[model samples]
Target: MSAPNIPSSAQRGKPSAIPGSSPAPVPGPNRSGNTKTSAPHQEQSTAQSPQLISVQTPTGGGAIQGIGEKFAAQPATGTATLTIPISATEARPGGTPSLALGYSSGSGNAPFGIGWSLNIGSITRRVSKGRPQYQPRSEGTFARIERVTHQDGPGNVHWRVTSRDNALSAYGRNSSSRIHFASKGNKNIFSWLLCETYDVSGNAISFVYKSEDDQGIDLNAVNERNHAILRGSVGSYFSRALPPLDFDYIAAATGERIARSVVKEVDWESLENLPEGVTGPLYQWLDLHEEGLEAVFAVQGGSWFYKRNQSAAGTVSSLENSTLSRTVTLEPTKVVNRMPNVSDTEKPRFGQWDVFPPFELWPSGIDIGNPNVRFIDLTGDGRADILITEDQILTYHVSLGYSGYGAPRSVHKRTDEERGPRVLFSDVDESVYFTNLSGDGTSDLCRVRNGENCYWPNLGCGRFGVKVTMNGSPYFDRPEAFTQKRVLMTDINGSGATDIIYVRSEGVTLHFNNSGNGWAKVEHLPSYFLPPIDTLASITATNLMGNGTNCLVWSSSAASDTCSPLKYINFNNGIKPHLHVKITNNIGKETNLSYLPSTTFYLRDELEGKHS
Candidate 1:
């Protein structure tokens, strides 16, 4: 067994020993051959022999296994060891070698038999899961390599390309270039990015190419980041471009129909029809409803109806029908007052008839056609009169004359002094009276003075001095001097003269004046009896029950004997002593009344009197 002569081909560029080869002898310097030649040249006959190593082909084919005897015969020198350096281009498409073999051989001459076998095995190339390589079909063409980056801060690399020209142009103009088509491929554990970028407007434009197939899993991740960047940039661009987009305009443009169910759910019963040509905002419609427009148009038309604006030329009749729905009517030639026509020479008719003013003409009073004003005499001669009261100052027009009525005109307008014409009788203290006291007139001027002492037990005393006029001359007379404590004057004596009845706390005192002069106190029996005096306590002198004599009836507090138990005292006697009568409530009703002597003697009565 000899060591094979293997070449050191692995060290550098050299060949190893052949597979079947024997070691060859080393040639050395022939010093012994030269001595032998100098000694007489004994015929040096080196036997010329053939080299042992040789190659021979197989004679017949058999069951071929392993290397299949392909290397059975070959010259050993020719089968030297070999080492081939594989270039990147020689590698497989997926960056893997298709076949690799390393071998060595020994040098041999006389057919040195060196045999070896090789088992041909399949090789699988492992591809990475990343961006694939972008192959350019044509030369001088470029592929765009787009990469997107997402940073933590506000800035984001929206769309970046590998080409310096594209990036520079895009940055210089601050604009985005269009993206052509892009495709993706999946590797074992990554993805491949194959993209093409070209100019859409130019004919001679070239496409840029990129190959990222060999890239690892990071390529897929980069692709995902790029996708997110693209989405965000697109969204931001759209948002910026469409600013101030009103939803109402969009809805209207889209012509969205309101839901019928929503309309039905609203409270239509409360809605009122609106006038034409009026529109409202959504909030106004929701809050005010259609009636708001109707009211506005009504006010604009100056009536409770709808009408055209001033631009339309229409007649008064058309305007009336369109602007008004109802009209008001009034009466004329109405009775104001009535009285016995008395001569001017006959003492001016002591208690003359009163004339009432028309209600419409009276200031600060009830309106005309008011039920309360129906009692007013529309054609009264004293309509021009004016009443001055604390509550209000009223002016009346009767026969178009102005006279003082109701509360008396204060003598000194600026005087704070209490000396003035005041009403002698009134239900409430400090209240001014507004009624007709002179029988031959309309509503007259009157008022009741409130005295501080009037409410006190013994100190409550006041006087009303009336300045009467005779023949256009004023005469001073104290009608309330003797009949001071709450008195009323009327023709109670039937002597054609006025009398006064003073309502005192103990009883009522009757003062009769035969000559129409001041009264003199007259006391009647059973004067201690008085009626329940509430707010309705007043005296009325009238021909009640159709009697020919005037009667005096006074109402006072039941506990205060100032009055006679709400009874009538008749003075029909053509003599000195008048008749004393007692009246009773026929029933609990205010309208029913009876005489105490007998119920049959009671008669329905209409009491007419005057107040000042």
Candidate 2:
């Protein structure tokens, strides 16, 4: 679908499909669609509208309007969608759920369902595992926009639904003024517009309310609240099947639904106007049914930071220029801390040291002076120490607790090699290793002994070696058959023994620790067997999913169909690379990304963002 044009009377008149909605007979073509967005009211103050479509007030003149005060001007600039989070059962690292559906086993327990339009009768017939097996349902309309409510009956909004045989049914009444649409899919999520009925005097008698379809879970359960999304409009009435729920309904062009099922509400707001150009939904909240929490993540620009249990009215206040989403993020981290930049020594104190700004472990000059830099607590002081290994000498900036970094000290030195040393452990029992480009550089002296050096710089010299050490004591300096390949030292199996993994454009090579002895052998994991992870902006392998082995994450600018801008190389049993999935959050072009060990992968989205 093209970007949605700003919502206006003109746009409202055109038919729009309500995704993730109940399968109802939509009443027409593009121009005659049943769903409608209210047109912009004649020139009026954006803060407040000139005319108040007020429900009966005690004084009868006017009382400030509330429900839609935030989303009054949603003449949708473009159609938007919502993604409700399903099962995070796949959240890596120990089966911990990133987002989980409700789970309570009983006589009838099903926390997974989809927005569907099924033959109500058929669902009552067949049984699966002793339970009725229902077909996939859809919240899509089958009614035409052209055949609209030509007339308003005594108490219902009526439309004609023609069958496949051209047999037109009479008076499609919207009895429950609002046909409550529910999604039993994995979560108790449902939505409906403010379709209300006013008495002759304009008093709202009832609204379109949603409820649980089968299990009959309490719609009013604590921590359970609905977000009244500004889903355009539905003409002046709702439409559905006339009497019997039989045939399918097809209407306007539709869209795929979002799957973030959790959300948090708040009071303060970001004054920045809503952004345009994006094609789909920017979810305001997600309701994690299993965590028993309503949450919203903080987005400075593109990267998202987590925040929990935010307060929200779940209503939008529309304006002429943009919709005043009654949603704001509360940054619990330094991202929004208003404190001035103070020296590390002068920074104000916080409950936990982790609450401070993300500490810049690598100082300013490192990037310009060295290419290979790693942060680890070499002294095991619980503070991350910086290690720079660009040249023959390694420099260390030991952590000074909360005070600052200690002076840089020349710790270990090694022979020439294209790559720097990689640390396997940070304790007194440290194991550091690096590739030796030459066996003592003696081959360069023997220069092109066979012209093979012209094709392969380090060929036949057999000088290719992986030098290892325990606390700087040499372990292995043998010839490496697979030299020049990217080497990464990580504890792949989580067995406390550091291992080596070799990476090449074609595939990857694994060298596990043989009984804790270094680099004993190798296993090649070919590329054809894995998803294509094209030219990468960055790549980090860690137990992000916490499934035991390592999960590789990379940023792909090419963003092929299989690879999203933010791609995850998810592992199956923590041994070999398995499947690949994209993070749905819109983290635009990335600047930097790193794995914070164990499971967290930190991403630096658009560095220009003012947050912290």
Candidate 3:
């Protein structure tokens, strides 16, 4: 036997006689050209030192496998030997899993006609046990968490969370603050966040955790980091993927608050049927439904009709409509609130003549009718009962839901300092109204007079609490400057509470109810939504568009008393955002118009339904 023809370390990059190389040359005394041969080693010598090694793929590299191997390179001069020792060993620090190692040998064209190689270790991942499965949850009163089904690969998924209502109360250190969207992949692991929620003021209020398929568990730092995140003390460490929300707008859009001053218009001349002898000064009122606002007009002769704005078959009919699906008798002489005196210039003009039409006409179960005779839901039965202010006495009639109203009982007796007794046909005093300022679904009393606003909460069972006077603001400091006619005590944001809608020559300003006597102005409708009104007697507010938003319904005293229900429309008409006021004419054709802030939009030749 002789040494094999192999290259030295100096020829490393060039192809040489390696164990796996092709067409290997055998080493012998009678073979090959410049190859040198040496006699077999007289005595074998061994040298050993500890070395760390790892096997990796083409992607990136990994840490040491913590296993060991031994090899001896054969030389062309003397016979060489190779050896591999297999043993069980612990996985390396920061390594993936435990591995088993082994080796194999074979005879080939080597100097001693033999060769050897080590087999790559096979990995056995330790399966995690007793891990809690993912479960969806909603915490606090407004924070919610749901699992995300969309996954990146086969391993794990993500969870999503959203905070609404008042964001400040969504999460904190309490149990209500912990809304789990997913359990950890390993029961011992802490939480991992994917996103976060912020309030209008840009403060983090909630976290969206990720735990579906993740296997990595950080036992030391993750828990503290997660606690810091929930506390909102982490600063802006994590990227804020979700933007802050305009709570007022979101409340209205999500029906969390009342849609304020959202008025819609309807022209009486557009309807199909009209009873004979039906003339001007017809009593009009608004009917609210989930779809939008419906305007009903009652002729003095017990004949009435309604107009609805349906994108498809919107029409004027005395028969079944959107809000009034059932036909009922119209008691003309029973209409209690008298139209306001048009000759009185200083008296509030809008909603003065608007009576809280019978609950049969307005299904919202709200007493947004006559300020004097209120039909409100003092109880949460979803039915309106009677609350009337007459002869200095306040009375109540509770609704039995499926049944009718209970008997009338006296709730309060007004003092002599209060306004005078209002008879049925007397002018409607715009300064006083019955609304749910407390948002308890019961009717409360509101009086705006001499630059001050007073509210009396409904204490259930027809009882009244002590009177409260709202603090003055720049918007409401001087009642004389804007007048009671400019103020509307209605729920504009769908907050279930009454908000202040102040109509000025400039635009409609909103004072959102703080759940107390105070008001906060979040946003307002621009000035373009001026309905044609000489007095509060001509304008009324209700849900006319069937979108659950309150809209203004009114008619011009100079235009044959023809009703124009002004639908509250917010749109970007060319230059900037303005209210998109849609008017339905007598022929049932819609005339689209744009209203901007600080501008009073009126009907013009270009704004006619025929032209549309």
The residue-by-residue lDDT of candidate 1 on 448-485, one tens digit each, is: 23211111100001112223221111111243432333
lDDT of each: 0.26, 0.31, 0.39
Q: Over 4 Å off in model 3, which ranges?
A: 1-281, 288-292, 311-373, 388-394, 400-430, 473-486, 503-510, 521-537, 557-612
Looking at model 2, residue 38 earns an lDDT score of 43
For candidate 3, report its TM-score.
Answer: 0.37
lDDT of 3: 0.39
Say which candidate scores most in lDDT.
3
lDDT of 1: 0.26
Residue-level lDDT tens digits of model 2 in 1-612: 121233323223443333333454543455666564442324333464334442332332332221110111112321111122332223222222222222111111112321111111001212122223224244254532222432333222333433333333323233332222222222111111222222222222222223433222221211111223457776587744222211111111111100111122222232112111111233233332112232333454544334433212122233222221223333242233333432343324322222344345434565532335665545433455666653345566877655656778774432433222323222233223422212211111111111011111111111121222212111121233333224465545333344555566676555544322223434555666444534433344543333234544333334342213323343332222211112112122111111111111111111224224
| Candidate 3, 1-612: lDDT as tens digits | 121223323323443232322443445545455666532222222643333323232332332121132333334322223333343322222111222222112222111111322232111112222123454343454656544443443223343545574332221222122222221232221233323333444444233323232122111111111122334443455542222111110113322122233443333344334321122456455442222234455544443344333321222242233222111121222222333321111223322234322322222333535655666666545556776666656666776543445666774453523322232212354466677766645566666554456666554555455566665533553445657656667655554567776666555555767554466754655555454334433444554433334544344444443333222332111112112233232222333332121110111111234223
Ranking by TM-score: 3, 2, 1
Q: Rank the candidates by lDDT, best first.
A: 3, 2, 1
Each prediction's number of clashing residue pairs? 72, 71, 53
